[model samples]
Target: MVKNQPCIEIFEIFTAKRLHWVVKDKGESWTGQYFRDIILTERVFPFLKNEENVIDPDEVIFINDKAPCMRAY
Candidate 1:
């Protein structure tokens, strides 16, 4: 990682035999609002919409380890 060069964050889903991933630009620090609005909306949503992946939106589950930026207060 380089300073001020913009970093990328990846969100991945693993099924029994396959993996799905979404990549997005990351900021210096992640905030709860930013995580949802940018990462979830811009990256994850579009990735989930790819028909080739055979993902069911209703069956999708999101899990985070209670990172500060992922909590809703």
Candidate 2:
């Protein structure tokens, strides 16, 4: 039996016409380049328009491991 645990440590979402999401950890922000090798490269929303407050630390929560990968595909 495998335990169901979230892979994301922290995350945030900026709700607009579309959802812009960001993930951060260890006090370092994750840029697209940071995920260049990951599947997020193709699926991620380029960059926040006007560079608004996208992901709030308060909104951080646990996300299933497969959600991000499936959403990208």
Candidate 3:
């Protein structure tokens, strides 16, 4: 018998009147390295860099909810 049910992590970003969705791959979990390397580096940073998404990249702020992966380190 399985002790745990299957699940995936997903989140959404708010851009003024726009909404952007981000979902992790199936069977994968969010880890500190993955968060630093992939999510922040590959995905989030690029999105923030785009002028269409942000007017001033440096002025953008992040408010962490103290996620497990973030505290994992």
Q: Could you give the candidate ranking by lDDT, starting with the highest?
A: 3, 1, 2
Q: Which structure among the candidates has the greatest lDDT?
A: 3
Point out the worst 10-residue segment of candidate 3 by lDDT.
64-73
Residue 21 accuracy (lDDT) in model 3: 61
Root-mean-square deviation of each candidate, in angstroms?
5.7, 12.9, 5.3
Q: Candidate 2, residues 3-55: lDDT per residue as tens digits?
A: 96545644434343345555544544466565544324432433322235334
- Model with the higher lDDT, candidate 2 or 3: 3
State residue 60's C-alpha deviation in candidate 2, in Å. 20
CA shift at 16, candidate 1, in angstroms? 5.8
Q: Is candidate 1 or candidate 2 better by lDDT?
A: 1
Task: Extract clashing residue pairs from model 3.
Answer: none
The lDDT for every candidate, in the order shown, is: 0.57, 0.41, 0.62
Ranking, TM-score, top scorer first? 3, 1, 2
Give candidate 3's error at residue 62 in angstroms: 1.5
> Evaluated with TM-score, which candidate comes out highest?
3
